[model samples]
Target: MTLKTEPFVLNMGPVHPSTHGVFRMRVVLDGEVVTDMEPVFGYLHRGIEKLAEERTYGGIIPLTDRLDYIAAMSNNFGYVLSVEKLAGIKVPERAEYIRVIMAELQRIASYLIIIGAFLNECGAYFTPFVYMFREREKIIDLFEMVSGQRLTYNYMRVGGVSQDLPEEFLPALDKFLAQMPVCIDEYDRLLKENEILLARSKGVGILSKETAINGSVTGPALRGSGVKWDIRRADPYSIYDRFEFDIPTGSAGDCYDRYRVRVEEMRQSLRIIKQAREQMPAGPVRTKVPHLVRPPVGETYAHIETPKGELGFYLVSDTSISPYRIHIRAPSLINLTVLRELIIGWKIADLFVIFGSIDLTMGEVDR
Candidate 1:
């Protein structure tokens, strides 16, 4: 004789705010407990890869800025590094140091937004998100000072950065750094040990180490799953090898650990910025590149640890001013793979906690 069991399936996204963007999860449940889940994509497809084939080398920089809009500096840095590799351009030492500092600041700002937004999703109200962005505003101020534009600062060129750091940039950065520890402490005080947050996040959405890597998780999300792999340290590209910082890892691989990883990462990023600022060289911010670049027929891939995760830019050049092909290995899109898998067997309310903990951006995922 055989026994029969029924399965329940539900869709958690494609329109859910907590999904971070327009994405969906097909979940199968067994008696109010999810048994299996699959994450669906292509909702916000813009065919960016197809679009890149037609844009010139310089023109592609602006588009790269949109990939992980939160960490625009790092996105540009990683993409331009690939182009530089392809072009065999030499960057000044000062330019490398300046790039590191700006990228670190953007990392901190992006994490602040995720933390505030994650906390808000747990129904703690809007206070934290508002408070978080307040600090973010100051960081954006620094970016504006350095590049003359906030958000999508077209401040990176194929060879090096577009401009030198402003004279006031250091002072602003220092001031922001001094205040960050206190703000971090405030967040810890507000939600770290709070019973509600702890309950909602702890032991929820667990991802094992093997599963994390199998699903191609990176950055804090992979660390949360107990992997010590960080592209910045493992690969040590750019001036990252000159720096000393800790790669924080988590044991539980839950929402809480992911949250902690990013929080600690912010602290580490601050340390990198301070070190970079103190050691910043005095010279031109940009390397010399042709107004129009025509590279030898070749292809290269560059990966960097963005605020979200590993952001890799793959370019194929056919010795033309415009790239023959371009591909963005986006973190958000890859991180979402295990999203439904983690949320299954959990309550619908817990979906937001899991989704926000992964820390996604539509700009990158859609692109």
Candidate 2:
């Protein structure tokens, strides 16, 4: 005799642990396999774009920090770049180099958090998570030295950084750069080829290159689908053109490929930071701009290769202290366009691993 199975509906979370941050997925399951899925967002929405209209251009810097709280520096970088363009401001040479260093360091730190959380979702639990966080904490220490805040660092300004690096910042950064490679290698040696990880993630949750592109996915997710597009190389922003680094792409676009891309990207970030450090010059970190910046009546858009993906900002000014309109091209939300397709037909157990591999923070999604 054979037993018949019926389909059931399940709500993964607006509160469940694996949704990453206030995200929910409504799934239709036939036993252990997910037959259909719908992603639910906006649980954490705060109407940030609307708020930008009320705040001065400079004041909006703090607001951007809240967009991707995990990679706040990159959020600040992208927003300030847009504001600078609208105002026709030029950043100082030294400030350009400093921005590159801070942005690259933030990339590594943000990747570390996602990688740790991804592994934890895969069932390795807090052991690997704690190990990765150990390195992330060191990066946080360096950030704290410069910005005095571990997270939500409103460090970048319209024409440059808000302040110069403190006396001990470089020495501390040097120490971190020296030790980070060893830690990365250690992580690779321990988990990269582990049988359990390979079995769990190797060929699961495959996203096709065409699907990724058509859906407008960017960053590691798009690159993991074997696309060689990186905004730093495709469209050079700041002093990224002055640096030498390789864009890492994955072949199969599976969970393992996305995981591998992030790990390799961390190494590339270290390379960029090293070049920025050696080529940095001494000059005023911030350009002289009015306290209340009033750009001519016009609009501008600026984007940067943030840790998760391409984060872009669009700003419109009407010669006022505050912006007339603001819109953020948030990668976290854009990248989720293909989530339902990726999750459908996969086992319930693989759902968390697949979703975690995308590496999205709800702060950006709900904004």
Candidate 3:
């Protein structure tokens, strides 16, 4: 049996600049309405997971950084958590606080990118984008100071972090924190109530709570869809339970809701950063371990709340210096699970708005 229908077909991306990265959308349209959508990936398959088997335990940390490339510290933290649990390594309290600080700071930085880029896609041009970056640059400066490198930070180790907080790090971080709230407000004034942004995003790309769960969506995407679920709170790890913050969620699960959820999430992350900085203790950054790191034959799955969503690492060890199997359950990939459903029955222009609202990173999605 065969059922065929005529639908105007077109490609959304693969080489388009607005895709944010190497992403292709196969779109079926009827006049101005979308009929169906399929996302195509694999343009940037670096094979890092398979390569992890060949590298030593210590060698894989830097490779994890390339997975998300946005929240590099959170990627590093999740991988190290699985490895540490597998090897029975106890990270010092001080190191854990440092990890939390870095993770939260990176989370804020990641949201800044999303807000700026999403506004740009909404056709607000450079005004909002520039406003978002002004705060993000300060966070990047903090990363550079501590890690000795910015984007591809190789500052994570299996047992713990690779470096201690620099002498100037805390004071600089405090200054950035004091200045960030005003910057976030500036972004609010620019796009929050703008009729253009609201009209484009408010009712577009609605996803229900139940559907969001079945699709395995996590992070802000799930929250935006009216699910008050956060992996950080649901499955607290690495002293995250110690922090006091609210999980901001939405009711309509539309593009506007997604935008609002992430904005509130950025504010929550800032709160976590302040708490971590105020309660920081002085101690060693990394745990003592052998040069040739190996874990007993076992498996461990460690998950953390990355800026994008629940970033998890599944590691199986066979008592070798490298993992026998590594599975990166990236939230960006899971969040894209519902793109087809959201794009249907909408205008082709809404495709741009919906994708931007989802806030995906091609690195994690394709990984």
lDDT of all predictions: 0.86, 0.92, 0.88
Which stretches of candidate 1 lie above 4 Å from their native place? Answer: 1-9, 29-32
In model 3, which residue pairs have backbone atoms overlapping below 3 Å?
none
The TM-score values for the models, in the order shown, are 0.95, 0.98, 0.97
Q: What 10-residue stretch in candidate 2 is worst by lDDT?
A: 12-21
Candidate 3 achieves a global lDDT of: 0.88
Among these predictions, the greatest lDDT belongs to 2
Count of backbone clashes for each model? 2, 0, 0
Q: Order the candidates by TM-score, highest first — what do you get? A: 2, 3, 1
Tens-digit lDDT string for candidate 2 (296-325): 999899999998899999988899899999
> Model 2 clash pairs?
none
Please tell me which predicted candidate would have the highest TM-score against the true structure.
2
Model 1, TM vs. native: 0.95
Q: What digit string (tens of lDDT, one per residue) describes model 1 on residues 1-367?
A: 8999867778877898677778777878777776778877778778877888888888888887777777889888988898888888888999899888888989989999999889988888889899899999999999899788889987888878888777788887889889999999998898889998898899988999988999999989999989999989999889899988999999999999999999999999989988997888788877778998888899999888898889888889999889898888999888888886787778767877888999888878888
The C-alpha local distance difference test score for the whole of candidate 1 amounts to 0.86
Tell me how far the alpha carbon of residue 192 in candidate 3 is from the true structure, in angstroms, after superposition.
1.3
